[model samples]
Target: MKLLRAIGHLIITIFLTALTQVGGLIWLLVLLLASKFKLKKRYLFPMVYLVFNLLLVPPVAKYFGREQLPVFDKDLKPRHYLYPLLFRNYVVPEMKTLLEQSAEHLKYQSIGITYLDANFPFLDGFPLLPHLSHSDGKKIDLSFQYVNSKHQPTDKKPSLSGYGVFALSEQNFTSNSCIENGYWQYDYSKYLTFGTINDLNFDSKNTKLLIQELLKYPSAQKLFIEPHLKQSLGLGHMDKIRFHGCQAVRHDDHIHLQIR
Candidate 1:
């Protein structure tokens, strides 16, 4: 079964790679025509980056470093299914190692990570919905390990909404977010955060350990979590642990770890 699944994933990935090539060419042609009419040169490089990916070299372009995105380790189960095929979970070597090490540590506690947005295979400017800073493949969202009232590990995913302390009773997975479907609008209201009340809440020890593990990586740049969480965890470093601060969506359910 494992062999069959691996073969299936490979086939689908190859198909998507071909599709990206075609899509990149189409975008390039459109951009070229737009450029002929003396359109702004601003979007030129970004468009070229997309085209380069669609061409023979679909993973890296001059806009980005030569190091292409690496496929994630199978141990990290994706909270969102299409993430694997869409290549949104790819990461640099350093980040991947950090996550692997983190996973190893979490396994002793019987916990796992929920992988989220990486970036489109080729486009830097191309938007990956429900995110503002993930276009560069350096940013990733992951669910906090949820624990029961006794603080024991549970089968549940992350929880909490909006503010961490204030949003104890709310849930976030109400979104129509799914793969194997056509176009659909995103339900931005659904999200998880710390301080989720009732039978389930974010485990402080596990969450703190996750953050500490991420910070261990030398390439680690910043961590975007809610303000209240930093205080609750007694993590007061302004340099690394920065607050997203109501700029876009509330990151209560997941922490955004970005690397240099």
Candidate 2:
């Protein structure tokens, strides 16, 4: 009886040690993965740790009430807009109108506009503009279809035209006011026509015309012309205007228009 008890205790000790080692390795893996990837650190890392502890630590399971994992039922109806990508601030109706008009002009059947920092689960591969980082409540990032010659939606970027309209140049800056507030300040006289460009094709004149039409909506007050064009148009002459907004800092890949 004494020998049997000792053997049982020895087995328990080995099992507990192995369990602790496995748990430690899992935690180490989580740390390594989190550090290596540039994803949401706060939301993802803690969730991983919590799941790990709950599964491997018997004490955690006992304290938290272990239950079978819930299974998703396909028969159940899904909610409409069930998981909308949440934005930092609510978008104004005027902005929504502008986005809708733009989408319509492009003949895109599906389009969406939300605050710049909206959490887009579907757009993980695409490089999101910096203005969409949610720092300012005014900026927004839009997603829409870029149609091809066949009238079908394609994952292509759009193109813009007109020298002063979309091009950032030194001539655009007429005064010091445009420079002082990191180029956040604007004057109507300095305004120019602008359009979107994608895939090195500038034939999308229809998109530019559509933008012009949208600007007529009274809400399209502050149109964010591309910084490259701004520089090309002489807006870069002033140090302040050259680096104003997030676009001035290499996020100029996309346009962030502000409707007043």
| Top lDDT prediction, candidate number | 1
Residue lDDT tens for model 2, 135-201: 2223353322245666654444443311112222333343333445555523322232144444432
lDDT for 44 (candidate 1):
64
Model 1 clashing residue pairs (backbone): 53-58, 172-191, 192-252, 192-253, 193-252, 193-253
Residue 213 of model 1: what lDDT?
A: 74
What overall lDDT goes with each candidate model?
0.58, 0.36
lDDT of 1 by residue, 131-225 (tens): 66676667777767667778787645543332233222243222212211321323243533433445677677777777887787778899976
Candidate 2, which segments miss by more than 4 Å at Cα? Answer: 1-90, 105-137, 142-155, 158-204, 227-247, 250-252
Estimate the overall C-alpha local distance difference test score of candidate 2: 0.36
For model 2 the TM-score comes to 0.34
Evaluate residue 142 in candidate 2 and report its C-alpha lDDT on the 0 to 100 scale.
30
> How high a TM-score does candidate 1 get?
0.58
